[model samples]
Target: MEMRAKKSSRSSTSNTSGSTTTTAVERKEIERRRRQQMKSLCAKLASLIPKEHYSSKDAMTQLGSLDEAATYIKRLKERVEELRHKSASARLLAAGSGTRRGGGGGGASTSSAATTTASGGAGSSEEAGRREDDMPPAVVEVRQHNDGSSLDVVLISSAARPFKLHEVVTVLEEEGAETVNANLSVAGTKIFYTIHCKVRTYVR
Candidate 1:
């Protein structure tokens, strides 16, 4: 009976030792897999960041890559806000134009009556002046993209002006702006142009 008990105790000790060894091996494997997953995730994150934001030597550490990604996200958020503000301003401008048209008819009629009463001999000059007043002035606005790789231009020009699309394109090309998209809309004798460009060089 004593020998049997000793054998049973020894067997149990060996079993416990074996189980501990197996558990240790399992833990090591789990840790290795976790590290591999983390490495893969870091690589994917680095891929999404722009190359320009990377290190000058191109040897980006994991922490450096993550930092660049954070900065890029910040810039994107700011760009979104800027675009929203521009959209709001455009809406307000449209509303104001509508209001002005509604209220300006009476004032314009009164002015015409006064002008006629003041002079009959200057009818041709008055008509010329009126035509000029009816036409909107030429407006050009150029904005750089947040990435510094592109430009957006909004141009409002009078239809009466001797403007040519090809000439404008040629000028932009000369200034190192490659036009990617060009849109034209006409409203009440005013020509609106929206041009999107990829810039190869700095344009003044």
Candidate 2:
């Protein structure tokens, strides 16, 4: 009876030991797989960033790629915001111009009609004036901000004319203005140009 009991006890101990060993091996394998997954993710992140942001030393670490990716994302966000602002400004200016042209047309027609009632001579003069106002060669308007730190140049020109944009840019460059952003749009036979410039740049 004593020998049978001892054998039973020994078998139980061996079984417990085997179970512990198997559990340890399984845990170790899981940890190794986790590390491999982390390394693969890091490599993928590094690949997404520009090569200029990475160097020989940056590739060796686990967190280096993450940092570079974060910085690149930040710059992209800033660029997007800048473009949004420029687009908004362009739209506002265009809208304002359209409103002015509409209002001017309304006023001019009323005034011309009143003048037409005065005399035959006045009617002929009104026709001449209408022709002159209908087709202006070009109009350039420079508007400076109240703070004097920046300015916007608006140019409206006939598409058929020889008004080159580069000439305006050259003039701005010579006048100590740094061109920040520019937009061009065409409407019918006319071209609209809006250039934003910095006022406090190097003057030479």
Candidate 3:
């Protein structure tokens, strides 16, 4: 970074004078500017120091008198603030036009999509999760043999819910669940089955 700064400054102030080297006056001015730049850089670095740092009283006593340290710190802080003010003023001066990002200085930049999206607010993610939970459990299939029987009855009946084995079996029977075959399972939940129902069907 220092090399880049030096190179830029050197290029900005070319030393050429009828093919001769830089004059003493120009060289002196450059050195003076360099010192000023270094002082400004030091001020910026000093501002980053945390305020109100603590040290053990015994350690501080061993190091130096608190009064002297405080004086030094106050000077550093004042210098940093002065430079920050200067930088802020320069920025304000350079900002001739209105604020960009398609927004006025005090106004927010909002897209049409963002304005229309009241549905997906703070509760949207939770609502989506709840919708997933509310989805109906899949209808288990139960195929029947020549003799009327189905796995559907056994499956729903075993569930520890409003539906039980006997209750579900009754439902399937009422629904004309016939040509019943066995059910399938995974770990615990009854997942799949194959059953042929009567021609007419109605949801309970």
Minimal lDDT window, size 10, model 1:
95-104
Instruction: Give the worst 10-residue stretch by lDDT in candidate 2.
Output: 88-97
For each candidate in turn, give its C-alpha RMSD to the true structure in angstroms.
Answer: 15.0, 14.2, 31.2
lDDT of candidate 1 over 1-100, digit per residue (tens)? 9999999999999999999999999999999999888878878998888787665554376667777778888888778746643553354344334433
TM-score of 2: 0.50
Model 1: CA > 4 A from native? 55-59, 102-204
**For model 2, how does the per-residue alpha-carbon lDDT over 62-163 read when each residue is reduced to its tens digit?**
887777788888888667645544554454445444544445367578666676676875776678567646766567677778765788888787664424
Ranking by lDDT: 2, 1, 3
Error (Å) of candidate 2 at residue 99 is 1.9
lDDT assessment of candidate 3: 0.42
Clashes of each: 0, 0, 14
Candidate lDDT scores, in order, read 0.69, 0.71, 0.42
| Residue pairs whose backbone atoms clash in candidate 1 | none
**Ten consecutive residues with minimal summed lDDT in candidate 3?**
153-162
Residue 81: error of model 3 in Å?
A: 89
